[model samples]
Target: MRRVIVIPARLSSTRLKEKPLTIIVDKPLIRWVVEGCLKTGEEVILATDSERIADTVKDLNVKVVYTPSELPSGSDRVAYALRDERVDHVINYQGDEPFVYTEDIKRLFKALEDFPVATLACRDTEFYKDPASVKVVIAEDGTALYFSRSSIPFMKLHSDLYPLKHVGIYAFRKEVLLEFTSWGQGHLERLESLEQLRLLEKGLKIKVLLTDNYYHGVDTEDDVKVVSERLLKKLSNPTTNW
Candidate 1:
């Protein structure tokens, strides 16, 4: 299938201001993400509403599509940017995940061959109890049963078993992505603020691809520093795993 990756960037990020332009080591965070995506050699497009963000991507000789600022979420922006394309599949990769491994991207794409939508998940930790760490429950067949910001499964007998943390990466068939944008916000989606639930509510199938590799995504100033330090460590020790 013809595949493309779209990074939904915006000028106003509530957590870190103008996050896409934030410098990580010697390059903007988005540039690192773009480079990682480049490793896959799939066509990539930056979907944004700001000229600053657009120009930044252009400076790197990367393709970008400017969408409206009124869009409710990144998923909507992705749908708008991809509306006219004849591509068979699209990957919604968050701009903040600078360390997104090429292997994870390829894994998600491979999972989508039979799944309507595919995403990454890893064993969770106590830190994931925070509502900000989105969690998911996967069925034995590798399908997602539910996605939530809160802890799922409500372990009646708590033990060392870890939950799954929903990594922000997602892959979908072109038609499924367009259909997702058309779906009205469902109750679970509205309450949880998770657009993926809207797809599940509409009876769409989502497959979960399990991975153990962890990448820090920039959500706050601290996250930026943390990821930068991690990158620097990797740079100094080329053999160090990220």
Candidate 2:
């Protein structure tokens, strides 16, 4: 099946100002995201509301589309971009997420063979209390039961595996994405301020893929500092050792 990566970026961020255009190392943050997706050798389309954000990746081998600045969320932006394209599967790669692993991208697309929606998660208890970090609880079959910004499962029992830190990356079948964007926001989604909950509220199963790979998105000044260090390591290294 035909697969692609669509990155949604906007300059008007609530937390960080001009997040997409923020420079990390020598290149813009959006450029880092685009280049990593390009390294996967898959077709990448950058959906953005800013011409300046679109201009940063102009020399790269990727397609850029302009969407309305009023678009609600990144997923909506991705869906809007793919409206004219003939794509079967797509990964809504967030622009702030600079770290991209080709193997993880492949796994998410491969999961579309069985699931309508799939996303990545990893074991991390550190962010359990951090409202900025979303947590997911999965059923026995590896399907997500719920996604929340609050601490889940209550941790009454001692275990190292309960709270799973949800990575923002998502892969969706094209039709599923179209329908997802069309649906109205749900109560839980509004409460948590997470878009993915809208899907769960609609009774659509979301497959959760767990990985040990380090994935982080830039959202604050501290994130920029931390991500810059790691990104530099990745770019400076000739091999994939970072």
Candidate 3:
């Protein structure tokens, strides 16, 4: 049961230019993600298209695989990178996401024991109205009902769980990934421009694990400032767990 964390980083980003190379605090954003994933003691593979992106983490103890820059999604980049690897499970850790928790990672992989696809979410009202932050609505059994860029489950009554901030990190069984990447883009996926929607449209159940841990993916200029302060604070306060 081998599990590997594959991080896909691209040089270009529509929201934030050179997102992977953007420096969060004292290090590059990609480096922060790489270092955190390394702490988990799992085989970490960095799937990137830029030499500049790969060079940032050149010193790290991680396998760097270069994929085509034209790959449509992060999931595709990882799948391309891992084409020759002998592994049972793969975690598509978004490069823009700087926050990485070991326990949360373990839980994601553990879910694949029963679920074909699994992801993370937390109760963050901060992302409720923010379109950049995709929101998710889950069923009673914890499987996702839908994910949308627009605010979902319109809270006329207001429940704490009504709005769950979808964490982009996804854990996929190797076979499931093969199936996902092979499918054509779905209607909802094309409209919303979210790759995960393609899975739900195809009747693939997505198990979303709720976590209290902090996760902030750098998307816009504002996120950089927020994450920089948070990273600096974490570095200063050795005991502070983010």
Candidate 4:
């Protein structure tokens, strides 16, 4: 199936203003995200509402699609940007995910063949208590049951369950994406402040691909520092294993 990756970038971030343009380790945060997506060898596009962000990646060898600044969510921006495209699948990759793994993206793409939508998750105990890290619970067949900013499947006693941190990246079939955008905001989605919950509330099945790779998204000034240190470490040691 024909597939393309779209990174939605907005300038007026509530947490950190101009987050996409924020410099991290000598490179713009959006550039790092775009470069990471490009590593998957898929056609990657940047969908943005800001001219500054669009111009930032002008020479990055990737196409930039402009959408209205009033779009409610990243998914809406992506749908609007690719409204006329004939592509079979669209990957709504968040512009702040600088550490997104190419292999994890590939896995999500493959999973899309069996399900209309697919996303990535990683098992990490440290993030269980951290509400900033979204968690997901999956069914036996790998279909996601729920996504929440709080820890799920609360272990009252000793158990083998580990919190699966939901990665922000998403892959959607073109038709499903269009349908999703058409649906109005869901109650659960608004309550949790999580867009993916809208899909679940609508009874749409989303396949969750378990991966080992963790992503560090740039949300605030502190996040920039954390990502910068990670990038610097990688650059300093080329052979350093992840």
**In candidate 1, how many Å is residue 89 off?**
0.7
CA-lDDT, candidates in order = 0.85, 0.93, 0.92, 0.87
Please give the range of 10 consecutive residues that has the lowest summed lDDT in model 3. 153-162
Q: List the residue pairs that clash in candidate 1.
A: none
| lDDT (Cα, tens digit) per residue for candidate 1, span 1-242 | 58899999877889898899999899888788887787777789899998887776675546788999889898899899998888998899998898767787888888778988998888867546789889998778988889998888687776454578888888999998998889799999999999889988888889988887876689998898899899999999989787
- Provide the TM-score for each candidate, comma-separated: 0.94, 0.96, 0.97, 0.96
Candidate structures ordered by TM-score, highest first: 3, 2, 4, 1
Displacement of residue 186 (Cα, Å) in model 1 is 0.6
Which residues of candidate 2, in runs, are more than 4 Å off?
236-241
Least lDDT summed over 10 consecutive residues: which range in candidate 4? 153-162
- Candidate with more favorable, higher TM-score: 2 or 3: 3
lDDT of 3 by residue, 25-127 (tens): 7889999999999999899999999999999999999999999989988989989988888989999999988999999999999999999999999998877
Which parts of model 1 are misplaced by more than 4 Å? Answer: 59-61, 156-161
Q: What value of lDDT does candidate 2 attain over all alpha carbons?
A: 0.93
Mind sharing the TM-score for model 1?
Answer: 0.94
Per-residue lDDT of 63 in model 4: 87
By TM-score, how accurate is candidate 4?
Answer: 0.96
Better-scoring candidate (TM-score), 1 or 3: 3
For all candidates, the clash counts are 0, 0, 0, 0
